[model samples]
Target: MNDQGEELLARVRAVLSDAGFDETATGAEGVHLIRHARGVMLGWLPEDLAQPRRRGPRRSRRPAPADLPGLRRAFGLAMAAALRAAGLTVETRGDEWLLVAFERAADAS
Candidate 1:
C-alpha cells in the first residue's frame, strides 16, 4: 500500500476503534462492533400489545443479546454514520464493508 492508502486505513481504523469496534485478532481482516437489536431500538412498542407499558427513557446506548446478522447490520449502520460524521467520504461495498476516504474537491487537479 502507498502512503496515502496507509493513512486512509489508519484513519478508518482509528474512527472504528473510537466508535467501539474491537480490532479483529487477524488485524488486517477488519474491525467489528456488535450491539444488541434491543439496544438500537427507540423503545417503541412492539408486537400486538403484549406486555403494555409506557415508553421509558433509555439513558445510554448499551449492548444486549441479539442475532449475529442483526448486530452486524446495526454496527454497519452506526459505523458508516460515524465515518461520515468524521468528515470522510464513504461508499458501501456490499453489506460487508465500506470504502472510506478523505473527501476531495471535484476541482482538484
Candidate 2:
C-alpha cells in the first residue's frame, strides 16, 4: 500500500475505535461496529383506557450478528468514508481494494 493508503486505513481504524469498535478486531478484510438507534415517544391516553405511555419507535437500526460478511460490509463502509474525508478516492475492484490520493511527485532539484 502507498503512504496515503496506509494513512487512510489508520484513520479508519481510529474512527472505528472511537465509535466503540475493537481496533484489534480489525484486519485488512474489515471491521464491524454493530449499533442500534432508539427513540422514546410520549402520548396521552383516553380516560379509563390507559395512562400516558412511553413507546419506542417501531423502526430501529440494529447490528448484524458477528459474521464474516457483516464485518466486511461494515469495515468497507467505514474505510470508504474515512478515505473520502481524507480527500482520497477508493475503488473496490472485485477482491482488490484500491485507494488513490494526490501526492507531490519527487522534485528533481
Candidate 3:
C-alpha cells in the first residue's frame, strides 16, 4: 500500500475505534479486522447454561451460539457505516467480507 493508502487506512481505523469497535486481528494485507468490544447482548443468557436461563448462570460468560449471528451483523453494519462515512467503495468478492479503499487516479494529488 502507498502512503496515501496507509494514511487513509489509519483514519478509517480511528473512525471504527471511535465507534466503539476494536481491531481484533490483522486480516488480509489491506482489510481491517474489527469487532465490537462489549459484543451484542442477546437479551438472554450466554452459553454454558444448564437450563433455559430463568435467572441465568452465575458462571462463565461464554457467548451463546445465537449471539454469533448478531455479532457478525453488528460488525457488518459498523463497517458499512464507517466506509460510507469515509466515502470508501467496498467490493464484495464471493463469500468473503472485505473492505478496500484507495485514492483513484483522478482523486490522487
Best by TM-score: 1
Q: Mind giving the per-residue lDDT tens digits that candidate 2 earns over 1-109?
A: 5565455456555644565544333222133322111111111111222233458855322323332354455555666565456554445533223333344458998
C-alpha root-mean-square deviation, candidate 1: 12.5
Which pairs in model 3 have colliding backbones?
Answer: none
Query: What is the lDDT for 42 in model 1?
Result: 10
Choose 1 or 3, whichever is better by lDDT.
1
Candidate 2 segments whose C-alpha is farther than 4 A from its true place: 1-67, 95-98, 101-109
Least accurate 10 contiguous residues by lDDT in model 1? 38-47
Off by over 4 Å in 3: 25-67, 93-96, 107-109
| lDDT (10s digit) by residue, model 3, range 1-109 | 5566556667666766776654543332223443222211111122323333447557445554454666555556556676667666654422325454454568556
Off by over 4 Å in 1: 27-68, 105-109
Cα TM-score per model: 0.54, 0.31, 0.48
Score each candidate by Cα lDDT: 0.52, 0.40, 0.47
What shift in Å separates residue 36 of candidate 1 from its native position after superposition? 30
**Quality of model 2 by C-alpha lDDT:** 0.40
- The full ranking of all candidates by TM-score, starting with the best, is 1, 3, 2
